[model samples]
Target: QVTLLQTVVGAHDLFDVTVQLQPGGGIFQTFVRGSGDDFSVVVPDVTRVNKYGRSADCTSNNEIRPLCYCKSNLMPTSSPSSASKSTK
Candidate 1:
């Protein structure tokens, strides 16, 4: 969960965000600046991002689920060759 601290009007919309981490009960605050579809972290630089992988089968309330990728998601849902042999 995050709370909006302040918003500044300029060329781009600048705002302060305070992130309240669940489970561990920690706090992370940062400045996010962007306009329209573009946005980025401006200070502290503590955020970690996962760039590659498949979608994770995580619960809706999991905070980091959006950034997670599970190896199980890479596995095929079913094998066509195996299914054919079994049917025969």
Candidate 2:
């Protein structure tokens, strides 16, 4: 089973993320700009439920599950290294 080890919310128009895992040895990174009121969660290594961000839309009946929601409106950067650290 995969476990959610941590969550880091973005700030200052920057949503740079880096996730490190052990035993599973997984590493994921993604960057999202804070413009347009967008939010996203990215898990780089695998293409499972744990990799994508979920929305808070209650109408879809998906909100009851922790991983069901809207797709991010923000654009992803070409590289995680180019992402700026949020100041908040």
* Candidate maximizing TM-score: 1
Evaluate model 1: give its TM-score: 0.41
Model 2 CA lDDT for position 71: 38
Per-residue lDDT tens digits for candidate 2, residues 1-88, read 2333333453565555545544223444555444566755443333223433333343456434333333332335455545544432
Q: How many clashing pairs in candidate 2?
A: 2
| Per-model TM against the reference | 0.41, 0.25
Give the alpha carbon lDDT tens digit for every residue of 11-83 in model 1. 3478777665543334556788887899888774544232222354544545665445565665567789898
lDDT of 1: 0.59
Q: TM-score of model 2 relative to the true fold?
A: 0.25
Q: What lDDT, from 0 to 1, does candidate 2 have?
A: 0.42
Q: Over 4 Å off in model 2, which ranges?
A: 1-11, 35-38, 41-88
Candidate 1: list runs displaced more than 4 Å. Answer: 9-12, 46-88
